[model samples]
Target: MLDWLITNSWLVWLVLFLLLAIIEMMTLDLLFIMMSSGALVALFTALLGWPFWLQVVVFCVVALMMVLFVRPVALRHLRRGPREQATNVERLIGEQALALETVTDHSGMVKIGGDTWTARSSDGTAIPAGARVAVERIEGATAVVYPAAGPGPFPAQ
Candidate 1:
């Protein structure tokens, strides 16, 4: 088995590629997957009858190239994704709500999409109950809202 392995070193590269690819799946960090690409190149080099030392050099260079160059581009593309990929909390921005109680800059409550939330007035003014509001942003567990145009910006509490 050892003699056969010494002669067929491509198998070693193939195994290394598989192991690294598996690690990439677990980590999702893009590093291990870059090394796996190097292992794939080394496997091809070995298949073409290259010396082991040359195959090692090829693997190292290719892996270094991927890590230094391709990884950043891949990360940027991943981050760019789609605009609609905003999270649920992010989607809450600009959504309409109703002031369940008087909403002041200090404390209040509002209902957004049928869900109750701790609320604050973005402009530090009191918004009366039953007033329509729009979410400006979420700070911690609180939603900051502004009086939205249309009905009942009533002065309640």
Candidate 2:
């Protein structure tokens, strides 16, 4: 049994690679895939009839290189969406809204794109009703805002 395991070491590496790849698919975090890359290198080394310890060394080096270098590049390319494509929440960040009532730092109401939202003044000052305002950011269920008259990088409605 022991001799079979020793001679069939590549099979072990192949199983490990498959297992790690499955885990990487489940996680989608790019961690186990890097390790699987190492296992693949070890499998190739075993197929070449290399010493077990040398195969282990090659695995370690390849895994480290993949984790330290390749993973970041892969994450950068695959994980993040294009900057211009905003999510539903992200789309509201710079949207213009109409103050439905006097908005202070504590509480108020506003209509953004025909939907009413809990609102707050960004600077703690009171904003009168019917004023045009820009959505600065969102905190919990509240929309923090400022007067649209001020200079800001946010787009106009």
Query: Per-prediction TM-score, please?
Result: 0.57, 0.64
lDDT of 1: 0.92
Q: What C-alpha lDDT, on a 0 to 100 scale, does residue 24 get in candidate 1?
A: 99
Error of 1 at 6 (Å): 7.7
The sequence of per-residue lDDT tens digits that candidate 2 reaches over residues 57-147 is 9989999999999999998988567657877667788888888899999999988886789999999999999888899998888999988
Candidate 2 regions exceeding 4 Å error are 1-8, 26-29, 47-50, 60-90, 149-157
- For all candidates in order, the CA lDDT equals 0.92, 0.89
1-157, model 1: which lDDT tens digit per residue? 8778758889999999999999999999999999999999999999999988899999999999999999999999987656488687787888888899999999999998868999999999999998899999999999999999876433333
Model 2 steric clash pairs: none
Please give the clash total of every predicted structure, in order.
0, 0
Please state the error at residue 87 of candidate 2 in Å.
5.4
